[model samples]
Target: MKNQTSITSVLLMSLSDDQETISVLFIFFLLIYLMTVFSNFLIILLVVTCAHLHTPMYFFLGNLAFLDMSCSSVTAPSMLSHLITQHWSMSLSECIIQMFFVIYFAGSEAFLLSSMSYDRYVAICRPLHYSQLMSWGTCAEMASLVWSTPFLLTITYTICLRRLTFCGPNLIQNFFCDLPHLFQISCTDPTINVFILIIVGGTVGIAAFVITFYPYVRIFRAVLRIGTSDGKSKAFSTCTSHLTVVTIFYVSATFIYLVPDTSNLLTLNCVFSVIYTLITPLLNPLIYSLRSKDLKAALSKALHIHRLHPDTATRR
Candidate 1:
């Protein structure tokens, strides 16, 4: 086994080795990366500029959009570059940094989703207290906690990873440097890392999952209690988008992380990783914007304003 000094880089596996397949994948994923960035950015812009959207929910959404963009960025560029150039090797430090951000944003997004669910619960179940419960200050505090806590956890995980030596067979099975893939390549005993992953990571995931979905139980109950169909429809509409996103995120993520990464499952893991990392970000803005009348109106208004005054829009 080689020491840390000897292993300076690790090779990321490509989705395909065939030149034609690589080209097709490059084009497909490049488009996905671009759309994910642009759409998420649009959500942030709308939330920032549209006064109507300056509520606690949109505030959390803007943060989610930012996180989605960031999480997609953490891997998509590197994966896309590898697809195009077939140069799959990255410096070990770069890989670690990428892994850190990947875990950071992912964990952060999970908690943020829980926050969004809580926001929805307050709005629907306790409408009278929504203002008090989800004030700007409260939202800011939640956002701060969402970002900071995961950061510290990721730092601990990364520190543990750095202590491990990488000797031979440095090829990562996935398109990016993920925790499980990284553990598989370590020359040193990764028992501690695995322990932290299983205990801390599992606890965090379960906590976030409970926080995120438990509200929906009450929310559904409240929705069911509504007298009129229109009233029920309106309340359900508000939550459906968020619920869809949360479901997709957790389901895809669970498949990627929980499933055994055996030889037969490697390809399936790659597919799920694509769903979790690439497709989810791409779908978020579309899901929220399409389902939301307020967002649609705001987008339309923004577009009309842009068309009416392209110069002003460009200056801004």
Candidate 2:
């Protein structure tokens, strides 16, 4: 029989038991964490400095970049420290705090993603109404909704989930304290938690994403109906970056949550998480800059001026 007491008595699972693997994992994850942070920070800087990127699209792009940076930062750094010291110990409060940040940032990302989809939909579907609809005030409100509502949901679930008991061997198989990971490590029946996860993930993750895309789908249809080569190219050109982001985000997220929860499939889930954690943040900014004409122009001028500063300095 296990201890079934209050939330203070609950203990989390250790990350791993292998000493050699832990050290190796620490070095690898540290490098990844550094790159993820640096690249996203650079994107934020470029977005802020480049005048042409001051539009709604870039503004939201900056938001997504910041969220990605935050997401990786919250999860990666702690995991690295634990791995290096082979210390799988996380205090109860620390575990809850980690989970809070994880959920907050993850929920925030989910909301921001939906908002980005809405932004794309308006820009592509109703170009005439975009300025009116996606005005600065409107944009700020959209971002707020995207960040706040999900956080409330996550906090509610956390409060409920944290009340469960755990008084046995605690060793989490995964690299981090994920939602499903918590359920697996718990002593009590995680039926309610899993049910809530499915409900929230399906309702918020899938439904919200679908709702956001409804307008974009219409925009995509409208663009395809146009007969002109130039018109089709232009319409697609406007949406290609967003589409790429949508596919990467949706595909990876669905794979992680929708997969059957079993030991055999855990490896696949971890791999998918790595992509969401490591790659997409760095890739999104590159995709936007590569695909968007305004970004390309601004980035080019910014880089050119940057390159010239050294020569100008030498002359001075």
Candidate 3:
């Protein structure tokens, strides 16, 4: 109550209130979190240890894995804790921190997927120059831009958020700290926040979508131009996994955030949030690893090498 005097904390509602349901949800989410962590970590480990995966494509994949892990971490642990204890209290500062990273990682991922698409475009469409275009230095720069742009955007938004006050009821409808829920509870005018969300969020999402899919337009043309069926098949195979990932991610994210957020849609929001936050992270590594024979072979080779020389894997 003392802290409430200054609006220091907000209480979050649980996904479920029934004891049995809570128990089930806790187990389900715990498993999801663990799997996301393990899968992403495995991808990172594979990319780092496998000598064959040192290309720009794999470099972007590694960054994607890291972003997936980070994006999930921003909200999943708190959701897990709330599922067990049903005590979802987060201080103002903590909420802001979570919101910033959630936005940063999620936004970065949107752009990172676009960057990966560029890498693929260069590989498939500009095969001869792929090496020069997607060099390590260029890949590093792309990765830095993908990450740093979102970092700046989120920091700017967070700074704007800090200027607003939260003097009303402090119950966040969702399990995590998201902009919509926070906007619903803000005492100060949220016009600035709404503007930022529209301007920054819309620009990022639209640009990412265009950048990610435009390459595909040319990629499809290039694939069709392949003289041999085998060549076409191979090129399509390389893209299908990425296309699948982009479809799921953009669909779920667009549905969750861009759609109308009415008071009665809390349940819908939570369900959609789970899709993008928890399920998508789990799916990314599986899609990439399962689809890429190169990754599988490298993983097997790395494990074999690790067995023969464990120090080699660790040193990477």
RMSD list, candidates in order:
1.6, 3.3, 2.9
Best by TM-score: 1
Whose lDDT is higher: candidate 2's or candidate 3's? 3
Candidate 2: list runs displaced more than 4 Å.
1-28, 311-316
lDDT of all predictions: 0.91, 0.75, 0.87
- Give the per-residue lDDT of model 3 (tens digit) for 105-189: 8899999999989988999999999879988889889988998998898888888887678876898877888877788788778
The residue ranges of model 1 lying beyond 4 angstroms of the native Cα positions read: 1-5, 314-316
TM-scores vs. true structure, each candidate: 0.96, 0.86, 0.93
For model 3, the superposed segments whose C-alpha errors exceed 4 Å read 1-6, 306-316
Candidate number of the best lDDT: 1
In candidate 1 the C-alpha lDDT for residue 2 amounts to 50
Residue-wise C-alpha lDDT for candidate 1, range 170-244, written one tens digit per residue: 888888987787788878899988999889988988999999999999999999999999999999999999999
| Tens digits of per-residue lDDT for model 2, 132-200 | 999999999988887888888888788887656664345555556666666665778888877787787
